[model samples]
Target chain A: MQDKKQLITIKGTREGLTLFIDELCSFNEAIKELHDKIIKNKPKKDDPIVSVRIKLGNRYLEDDQDKQLTEIINQANGFKIDSIESEVIRKEDALKWKEDSKIKAINRIVRSGQVLEVKGDLLLIGDVNPGGKVVSTGNIYIMGNLYGIAHAGVDGDRNACIVASYMKPTQLRIADYISRAPDYESDGVYMECGLVDEGQDKIIIDRLQVLSNKRKELSRFERRVQNG
Target chain B: MGEAIVITSGKGGVGKTTTSANIGTALALMEKKVCLIDTDIGLRNLDVVMGLENRIIYDIVDVIEERCKLKQALIKDKRFDYLTLLPAAQTSDKTAVTTDGMKKIISELKQEYDYIIIDCPAGIEQGFQNAIAGADRAIVVTTPEKSSVRDADRIIGLIEKEDMKEPPRLIINRIRNHMMKSGDMIDIDDIVQLLSIDLIGVVIDDEEVIKASNKGEPVALHPNTKSSIAYRNIARRILGETVPLQSLEDEKGMFQKVKKFFGIRA
Candidate 1:
């Protein structure tokens, strides 16, 4: 009884019941404990289905072990595994996450018919000529004129924004929303940013200053520098 | 040994054939052995513009398909002993010539000529691909119009993406003084800056160019017309000369002075 109690703990919260597997226990021991507890506390047949989440605190499970843990919880009557989360991740996944968060810098003109794409954020230092297109999964920062098409958050990230030194793009897309430039001429002096407005349900082009207000995370470095 | 320059414009009726004829003639007149290859295939007009239409005994298709030797297919220009023309086949389509065949033929011509000017067809298709296959340099020609500039931008993008030796240069053709003054036409500076390429020359719109083309003579044959001077300047620039850009105001001012001398209305 003491060993089983030390191996796993079950708690109920507003979200659902959570099964906290002890990090110090062996994989086989935790699986056994989880199976016993779920079977012992199985809800009555008339009771509603109880969604349970598993928390692997500081413990990493192989694919088969993770599947085995889920199978044990799901097999119990009236209970299903909602999610399985671990504090540790695979090295390849960590590297991919790092890469997706990194900003790619390109210095060249995006002429007509040319398409420039990046997996993460993009920092373009040259003009995007008419007929050219730029696509990124994250935010896009252009230090030159944008007279073509720019699509930010191509993977459907609605929070992604596109900022350009000259906001004369023919079309701007953020996530699922697309807005074409009006028939007005830009003075080509002030910078502008295109961001999605949740309430308005369309992209709005505003001054560059609005970027800091909307995307506070983008100014984290500047904030840290100022605080120091 | 020699440089092959492809003159391309993504849109049609923007004077690609006229530019090729004039530039080839200007270069040949400068004492360089120049070969003008019309790669328009079915729509071949460079030979017609160069007045060598009847002399084409064997066209480029015959040369590429190995039906005739490259020397036999080449028609020497009637005026300039050094200038030559390899006419496009009037009957065959663009698919008849492959990029590999073009590379082979261009390599052979490069060995014998100082400059090989290829006149590319309009639109970004197999014809464009075949035209630019063996060229070492590219000259994108455009006019002062929204659609023309847009197409020129596309052609420039295609050329640079191919990783050519140097970036393609720009030639803004058919610039009108009155339309520019009235702000109806796109400015030369705007086109150059928008395309973001080097500006080789800007040819003013002149009726003399049309007359010369109708007569099967390149305007560059006569050195006096504004259009002819523009083509000659472009040819010189191709030869690494540092000629100054021609100003529209000078020509307009000269016209105003002529009107005053003739006692015309102010």
Candidate 2:
């Protein structure tokens, strides 16, 4: 038989090396080719460690397959797997991700002693009175006063934020960071937002304008140009 | 059928008992047959406030437990022919009565009365639940203090979740006019907006209210004091009559009275 077509390709990039696994081949064949490529590219003991990123083109790897791939790369000297990227995912996982990104809108007073929770982004149209709490897995946007506790990014999304028209919250939490309202209170003349500052690893309360800059992706609609 | 109104404040000493007594008397003075039910159980005081404590031959527990007839347990007010009091059991706790029992008693009273005002106890416990069980309307009493207002907010939330015909109205009690004017206390507007409920009335802090309560006579019986007029106005509003809210401004001293008499500010 003619030499089997190559099922895996390796290339060097500015960051490090990249391994491309062919999707059309059987998983067994692809893994064998990947193992061979790692052995061929193995460096000498004196050479510095080089990171390798694997790109699985339209190929989904189960947990076992992924672990096997990682073990093969680690067994080769001087190669560390930085990350694995894939363009395709299982339908159930894709649906779960979509569900987590949805925005849920609610209207009514979150009265005292009440706890309102959402799985994704929360859009509240009424006040969160003192002693009340609002929690969300994604972002929280309140069109009314927030006089109570608000916890966003309950699933540890540091990029999530809490925005309120009147932000006199007793306490705010984003990701794992918790912050109490400062003694010097906001007159609440303008809307405010609270988010985790990655640099400082603290929750920061700032004017609403900061949301536009920090969370530009919050605006889902794209502006279109008009043709006259 | 008569409507039952539960007067409650989740915090203690926010004037719930006083409001219930005065509102019941006010409604009676307006010739509406009114029955005031003291639901405090172990800490009964509406009878004392109504000045009918000594006349309590049978208490609400006696009526609910079938130890006495409902009519026998109800004590007619010494002053108003249309007003009556159903005092709570001083020896028993709130656990002595069930919501079903309270509802049965209230429904029986509703058949013969124009209004049944249930004086709820402080704390959202068994007493409060028993108080609101058979009510058709709710009136949440609160003071201008932050803690009291906060508790009122909580009570309002609980009351709204109930299937009452009308939303709970607010009665901001014991407002210190001078303190409010000096900005030392929360503003009436701020309390109203924060609670976000219809304000039935605001009773200014007046010593006469305590003196009247001590004498077992509701301040609503007195016609001239600011507290009295506030209660009467609240009573008229409950009667479906439009009554303007009285200003909480302190009564003018003699000098200012003379100045105003001469239309100085006009």
Candidate 1 residue runs with Cα over 4 Å from true position: A1-5, A10-18, A24-28, A41-53, A61-83, A183-189, A221-228, B250-266
Task: Quote model 1's TM-score.
Answer: 0.89
Candidate 1 per-residue lDDT, tens place, B1-266, comes to 99999999999999999999999999999999999999999999998888888888999999988999999999998897989999999999999999999999999999999999999999999999999999999999999999999999888888987868999999999999789889899988888888888999999988999999988999999979989999999999999999999878644477788998999975
Estimate the TM-score of every prediction: 0.89, 0.87
In model 1 chain A, the worst 10-residue window by lDDT is: A219-228
Q: Give the Å shift of residue B222 in candidate 2.
A: 2.0
Query: What are the per-residue Cα lDDT tens digits for candidate 2 across A1-228?
Result: 468688888899988899888889999998887887778867999998999999999999999999999999999888889999888888997676666777899998888899999987899999999899999988999999999999999988787899998888999999888998668845553488999887888998888888888877677532111100
Q: Relative to the true structure, how large is the alpha-carbon lDDT of every model?
A: 0.89, 0.90
lDDT of 2 by residue, B1-266 (tens): 89999999999998999999999989999999999999999999999999998898999899888998999999999997899889999998889999999999999999999999999999998889999999999999999999998999999899988999989999999998889989889999999888899999999998999999999899999999999999999999999999999987776799988989998982
Candidate 1: C-alpha RMSD to true structure equals 4.3
Candidate 2 accuracy as lDDT: 0.90
- Per-residue CA lDDT of candidate 1, range A75-171, in tens? 8778877888788887987676766677899999998888999987899999998889999988899999998999998988888899998888889
